[model samples]
Target: MSSKNSFYSIAHQVNKPENISKVLPYYSGLEIDIAYSASKKQWVVAHHDFNNTKHYSLEDWLTSFKQLYSKRKSKLSILWLDIKTLDDNNIKDMLSTINKHIPKNISIIYDLGRPLNIINKNFSYKNIINNLREIDGIGCWITKEDLNLVSKVKNQLITDKVKNTIISYGEVVDIDLEVLYKLCEINKNLQSPFSKVFVWNIQYIEEIDELIAWQEISGMIIGYKKQMWNDRCLDQLKYLNDLKVKFNRNTPTTF
Candidate 1:
């Protein structure tokens, strides 16, 4: 996907097993929280730092998801894994689990808090890991928290051969609209450092409208509170769903 196109996936963060089944059919993208479980001696799906008795094993979750997906005849475009905790001790196990569980066709996006030494290890899964440095929520290659440094970060990304990125879009500490547009323009070029740009921290209908209007974002991560999807929110989701279907028809698959 490039900045010249408006093809973007509307993703929802479903952190619970019960909710995953409920949400699988509505959205093409699902953002999940992954962490190591000491009790289970395996990876589990949960938003907390450590897995508890209530948490389900990652393998079980994926197995159930795959079964439900087949039964529902559903499709998932992206599986965004927010790595709550990762270290050298468990990296191998995590990767092995991923290789063994996830379907071959589904794409994975790893959202890590920092760079991992073994991050470059070869994996059988189709995946993309974001650049390390971050400020306010946007991940880029920089040591400081300055939006003005994005241009420099862009060059560094290209030099490092980085191809994917994630940005934050919130009312406070949000990226400037003009800067976001510039970043989008970068993807329009053949040598664009970032081929896929995903935005998160979005909380309002207007924010969704803005992304739709820009037509450059590759994906948007949305979170919901209980009883939060008002009529307008539902309307925006429908509009985004239509846009996703229309643009996906012409755009190539991206991770």
Candidate 2:
């Protein structure tokens, strides 16, 4: 795998067909909220609150994504599916739809919410793993408020039979470096399930610098806005690319 880290922009800002063209060239990945529409009997893209009346079908989004990725050809674009709801039928339906549309060039990462609620009559972690094992990875969201729950969930995932790449979304206040360091340390000590850690909603570039300095973290997920392609964001992307090159050069080869 390339040592270069990736940047993922939240997809809601670019939910429209026309906006896809604008965001694709700048971002390496798109984090989309996956919600089930029982009325439509199809999955749609919407935030956790599910309040937004405008719904973008997952299939439509994937089609646009495939085209954009083909055109870009410079980097592997990622699709982070932030699953808002999961049941046996919906999980199967979601995976089936994804498998049909997912291209080889695009990577997939599932954000299966907290662990405690994952296993029940309708859904099981094993089932989710079996479905996603062929894809990129799977993870859960963690905030400072629920650190203990996150740790337990991570531990359980690590112990699972299928050893897919594990990732954690660190949702914190102001990109707290100290909190990030502690999270990494906990993962290392516990034989963490995660191979990557993504700090969400970062508003500034200095957080990226701090994460790179730590060397344990992997990437950042920036929330997309109208001005996402502005000079500041572009400069930050350039700096990350440079850092990736420097790190790759410094590392020794393992035959």
Candidate 3:
């Protein structure tokens, strides 16, 4: 794996403390989604569509994360905070809670949902960006199916304020290298070009190799669904580890 690119495990689907223990050690990044609970007036770690009865409060989840990070003393390179519901109060609360519990070592990426939602509402996008400007990174979901909407959001972020934004293309149903290359080209041309490109719901391991070849892109984060982990997933992990070793060996020694 290139130093600029990394792997992330989509632990939101499993959304359990034990699953974090199982997956955190294997990857450089962990992707988790949080939904706001109006009644509780708190953010809980759960997918948006799921019933709210079982999820862990954002505070509790972060506490568990802190304990795990301490015990392993492992480098948790990226923390992808996928905000399922965004509002002024919850956003403030979430940021405050994160700052208090999560260690400073981890880089936090705010993965906001689709771009059009922001564009449609008055001042909504700006408000979100203003809040996110303080984070290490910001990402928005994009797909080829909606180029116009994607272009609008891309143009808005090109301004000077927002930095280290990522364009996340959901799921890998098929590998269209040319299309992906073009997307990367557009990203590079942005005044504030995206610092990374991420993809989830990956089904084939070879897609990883293909995407890695595109060094023109700033960085890449490959993700897998939580429930899909099996022997093939193990194979991919092993392959990535081998690549890391090879990369380390090839670097010239500096004395």
The local distance difference test score of each candidate is: 0.53, 0.59, 0.60
RMSD of 3: 4.6
Inter-residue clash pairs, candidate 2: none
Best by TM-score: 3
- TM-score for every candidate vs. truth? 0.68, 0.77, 0.77
In candidate 1, position 126 carries an lDDT of 16
- The backbone clash count of each candidate, in order, is 0, 0, 0
Q: What is the overall TM-score of model 3 with all chains considered together?
A: 0.77
Candidate 3 per-residue lDDT, tens place, 64-124, comes to 9889888884545677777777654557677778878877667677777777654554233
For lDDT, candidate 1 versus 3, the one ahead is 3
lDDT value, residue 190 of candidate 1: 35
Off by over 4 Å in 1: 1-6, 114-179, 182-191, 205-207, 225-236, 242-255
Task: List, residue by residue over 101-203, the lDDT tens digit for candidate 1.
Answer: 6666566666554322123332211122332211112232212243444455446545545545553333223435665566566445535444456655345
On a 0 to 100 scale, what is the lDDT of residue 90 in model 1?
70
Best candidate (score: lDDT): 3
Better of 1 and 2 by TM-score: 2
